[model samples]
Target: MGSIKPAKSLLYLAISMVIGGTLLNVNELAYLAVFPLILLAMGLFVEPPSGIKIERIVEEKTYIPGDEVTIRVKVMIERGMGMVLLRQPLPPEVELVKGNNAWSLFKGPRKLEKELTFSIKVPRRGLYTLPPAELYIEPLLKLGKPGTAFLGNPVTITVLPLIKPPRRVRTTNTRSQIPIPLTSYSLTGPISTDFKEIRDYRPGDPVKFINWKATARRGNVLVNEYEREGKKTVMFYVDARPTMSVGTFQENPLEHAVSLVASLAYYFLRRGYNVGLYIVGRGELMMPSTGNRQLYAMVKKLMEVEVLSSANEDFKDAMRKSERIIIQYTPLIIVVSNLLQANELREAFRLLMKHYKGRVPSIVFDLFPYSMFSGKKVELVRLRKIAIERELKAISHVVHWDIRKTEISAVLAKTIRMVR
Candidate 1:
């Protein structure tokens, strides 16, 4: 206790004064010793104030990366108290955007109830816990020491990934060579296999689709109409190996991959398509579903992604394991990888062919390394560029994308156009 040292010094001083005063017959010294003894006695009997309480309120439990969060801390003292110091340690994933995290309050002779509020900016996506606030209460008597107590309960917050709304990528059938507008699949356009009525035939109408009975009755070229087809299933593969950790946070391959996946998943889910995720990071994570719930789950998983230096997860092995799931859903596969090696791309393509039997449409997003390491390490960047070009040439048969020159949405739009 802070009071122990001062109390002990006073007691020692009192004893020395009394002994010296008795030997030297000095009455002033003896009288002076009485003050020290009385101070020590009073300090030893002082009691710390009880019934102190602390409450904490967090404005929200979830946030996106770079969002500012507000935290309010309230301290209530049932009785008058002395000086108090309060502190709350923040998680390293966030930065103080406004206000202080620690404060010292000098309590007067009155009961105190005060509130402090501060804001922090989330730097990255992840789950973080705010540690409890600590209060150090100094004793009323100067000779007494301060006592420490923990206040407030720990609070958990989930920071979701930063999502950039992606441009719509129109869906196309596996065999269709023409792209159809998404609006065509609604009630206004023709739905596959569900007949609505017969209408006058237009130019380019298929002869096979013409209704002989309707044509004969109307005495004009009439064709059968149908409702639009249902939504398609889409699967996304995010490559999160250590190689993706290259570059700074602003341009890191992994960061870009997370943004891309979040944006794509959000776009497709909103369009009523079944979306699934297969993340190849420190471990294999899969979320095979659709709708807004699935989108949230996929983004949460991506938010917690970390690059493991010792991880050697084989791309072929991850793809092989995903084949069974992919076949069951029959989803349109989209692979987001850095494509640093030719063999990795070949192996991924091999697995897709094996599972889909060349009947399903697949797209690969090649995150070029040069875009991430711009203006640094000239020789290494050149080598990486050469390797990427070689790999691209080797896998010319598959539909591939270079996303360096455009936003993820534009690249996705281009892929949809090409496939359609």
Candidate 2:
């Protein structure tokens, strides 16, 4: 509603009545004459005219939850003769920690122009609106008149969700790229590689086979030696399976897993080894490759990985083929997954060595510890859940990882140390 203003003549009548009544009794003046004259003066003079306008501006367009943002309101008034009060309205989620009460009075009016700025923190992630401002004005008269009012337009702010790294991780029992010893190799000549270590010298030892350090420690000479093998390849198998979604909220487990895969790819590529990747569970395959380009491709893939549904296909066939690839072209394989499926996990890894052209060294990153999936109480009666966990651990030796309720970077660092 607009400001309420009583007719000025009302005040004049009350003033004139008192003055005329006293004068008629004491000075013998005409009461009607004095009252009518004062009333006419009040009605003839017009109250000062006024108008107000408000413009709003914001400091930022996007922010994460709990981020601070400032909003500025510029108030302008024209020919405003009187006291003007302005009050800014704010959203329910926004707290006006600064500025005057919903109202600020502009004393002794002239033309008024001002830019009032305020700041607020984004408490939640979503869209929000800035409330309107209430403008009030009152003429400088003793008549006790009401003030004018107006509501400004609404403003909107959008907040984005928080993407934080995990504290720990849960690794699954999947195939990996560790070195495996070969069983069917013919000796080309005498062993000539650098000495690795020396135990008691085997029978039929050559006179030059003695190790001085071993002799001093064991009271007898021990020989140290090494075997020769061709250069080996390193491949990373990431189980991006649907079943891997046991633990995650706004930040999915796959995001962290993908980072690990990408990092390993970079390291292997830098080491002059052919680094390849096998992505299981999402029905997509990235065969192993080496070079900077390959590493970037891996990072791009990992960045876009979304969690798979429960019905997503398995990588058992890929696991079987991994053996041959390792024997013919690769020597090391690193498997990373949340080992939620025991049989599938076992079969995938077992087939690697069993079906490979040669022995394959492997390290499994087992993302178990279903406890990390949630803080709520887990039902023990879920026979399938229990069975899956049991099979996961029994299938292959896995490097256990639990990424639940922890910072992602810290957990990844720990996992890297463990694998090393």
Candidate 3:
């Protein structure tokens, strides 16, 4: 039912006119009082617009960070309106790009419908909900107070992290790029174009593998053999401790760690390997699996990651808890974290080694948050970072990743190359 209440301003005016008329013994004042009283009486009988409805349509419910999102909101009212306003509050990380998210316009007492369109840019990765559109109606004659109603149902959008390609690092003395080898095993696995060698053609070999140049040189049929990629389980350990919150929220150790985990998960999933995740402080895990579904699931978990100031989840304890899964999967363990204390990491690695029969090949990525300092602090932080990296190397393959100087994928490739 439509909701309408008499305007308090009009009620006070009516009361004042009546009191003045009686005190002054003026008939004109009494007649003048009738105007506001009539308006109040009419307000009691009237109602605000009814049958209001709003529906929100998002162009894509899922988006990558820094991508623009288009939104269309439709408002429909069956009958009765003075001025109708529709507005909705957006998530803090979202910024307007195209049109207004709020709409205000005069409407007559008839069926009213309008479609409002706008665009927004999502800057960060997370699951965000757009609040329901609010509909406010004001009586045309100023006879009744304004009425408010929440219109549309909330819409949720998932902002996924951007996946960037691997970047190469520059060397002081060499111009050649580092070779990235993706090792594969098994006879039936996918083969890389990286030709291993040309051998005499074997029976039942695919004709497409014939190397014409080698055949002409030797005067015999030869086949090119390529590197065969094999499957492996990769478990990612992403530290969520407070120490990772170093630098700005937009560019921090924690942010890079999450993105690094996501990108690596993507890299492995495409290679037919099962990937698992362990959010260190959060204790969230995704059992090892393969395919785009796994990538999506991993990214979904990563999108929810945030640096908590109070979660003091022990690294050693986290490793111990996942000992069973680690043994079962026999995954290449990947740890993404900032250097806490050198001894603390050694303890964590010790617990990890206890579960494996042999040394489990593990890589530890240490993020140097360059954004945390200016000119003077750089040299000092650099020296401290090197010391930490040096200490960490004794326990695991350490990849020193400065946020400004390197890409996550590049450092990851470098680490993987070193492991190989």
Best-matching candidate per lDDT: 3
Candidate 2 at residue 46, lDDT?
31
Across 1-420, the per-residue lDDT of candidate 1 in tens digits comes to 567778888989999999899999998998899999887776666554546788878875568877899989898776544678889889876789899999997665567789999999877777778988888887655566567998778988788877877554556545434222321132322347867678889998788989998788889999997755545667777887877776665456777778877877787778777777777755565646678788878887888887777877766767777777655555676777766566765766666665443434555666764653456574575577566656654433233334455676666566555534
Candidate 1: give the clashing pairs: 2-145, 3-145, 190-227, 190-228, 191-226, 191-227, 191-228
Q: Report lDDT per candidate.
A: 0.70, 0.58, 0.75
Provide TM-scores for the models.
0.72, 0.43, 0.72
RMSD of 3: 9.6
Error of 3 at 384 (Å): 1.2
Expressed as tens digits, the lDDT of each residue in 165-224 for candidate 3 is 443344454422211223213234577776787889999989999999989999999999
RMSD of every prediction: 8.2, 13.9, 9.6
Model 2 local distance difference test score: 0.58
**Which regions of candidate 3 deviate over 4 angstroms?**
1-47, 165-231, 354-359, 412-420
Better of 1 and 3 by TM-score: 3
Q: Which portions of model 2 show Cα errors greater than 4 Å?
A: 1-231, 247-249, 310-312, 321-324, 355-360, 368-396, 405-420
Query: Sort by lDDT, best first: what order?
Result: 3, 1, 2
**How would the candidate models be sorted by TM-score, starting from the highest?**
3, 1, 2
